[model samples]
Target: MNILITGATSGIGKELALQLTSKGHKVGLMGRRTERLQELKDEIGDIAFIRTLDVTNHEKAEEVYNSLIDEMGGMDVMILNAGIGRIQMLPPWEAESKLIEVNALAFAHGCHFAMDYFRNRESGHIVGMSSMAALLAHHRAAAYTASKHFISNYMKGYRQKAKRMNADITITEIRPGYVWTEMTERAKGMFWVAPVEKAVSQMVTGIEKRKNYVYVTKRWQLLAWVAKLVPEWVWDRL
Candidate 1:
């Protein structure tokens, strides 16, 4: 299968690209770091194509998708894995809105683009990387949590719309608890940190099974459900 992954420079996106390419799948890697992209291309040999792109740039992102589709002949899957997470302890009003732009708006655009392509071909998969944080409000990372919630909700709506239209496109939302990626490397003492390889392996399995919603670790699923049962006061205490 031919796959296009955004934010392919680091963390889960990079790990997914490596895993997929090693499995002999054609991969189109999209990221802003040309150096890392070139390194990946060299390491992965000819099956991997690198596109230096910033997902937040709507025009560039659209162009990259079209170019990749043309270059690869066609894409079987599009993974909207590009995201940013930062601890924002300030008032919500003072937080930078770029988190929303990157995590939510960029993902929405990718979903729309992928849906258009898949709708035309009448077959394809759209995978969005949300976080378990979407299940609850986080005090220090309000924007990040909100963005993830938006992603999860957006994918849910897309799934419903696709079902109603009888579209062949399958939308999968992956909610990971905590993975040992560069983004979370600084988060020490977090026992929930699953190795990147482990997380990606589970994610790949879920994708192959066409699971609509998946938690990378099974424990995350239980935690998400438990979080929902917690009262606002109890949640705030965490």
Candidate 2:
């Protein structure tokens, strides 16, 4: 399959590229870091197409997506993996706004584009990188959590739309717990942190199965169930 992965420069995106390419799939890589993109292209060779552009740049991103699809002859999947956490402390509004733009807005754009393409062709797979935070909120990362919630709800709507359109479009939302990537290496209070490879391997399997919602590493489902079962008053204390 021909797949395009955003944020392919590092972490899960990079690992996905390596694994998928090793499986003989053509991958189109996009990220803001030119050097990192080049490195991936070099390592993945001819089957990898690299493009440097922020996912927030919607126009350019669409163009690059199409260009890569052309290069690969066709596109079968779009992985909206580009995302950022509240990794640094900034002014409240600034941090929240940035997270909204990259994680929520940009992700919505990718979904919109992929749905359009797939609807035309009547088949495609869209993999969105959501988080367990979609079910729980953090006071320190309110916007980040809220954004993921939006992704979950929004993707649900799109799923209905796919059914309405009668298109063979699969929208898979990945709600992952802590995974030991650069993103979570320094995170405090993390438990059951799956190795990046193991986490992404499950992700690939879930994506291949075209599951609507995937809780990475499987054990995360216990936490997800707990989150749903816990009383709101108890969570208010946390």
- The most accurate candidate by TM-score is 2
| Candidate with the greatest lDDT versus the true structure | 2
Please give, for residues 131-161, the per-residue lDDT of candidate 1 as tens digits: 8988888777788888999999999999988
lDDT of 2 at 226: 90
| Candidate 2 Cα errors over 4 Å, as ranges | 87-89
RMSD of each candidate? 2.0, 1.1
* Model 1 TM-score (2 dp): 0.94
For residues 58-144, write the lDDT of model 2, one tens digit per residue: 999889888888988888999999999884778778878988999999999999999999999999998999999999887877999
State every prediction's TM-score relative to the real structure: 0.94, 0.97
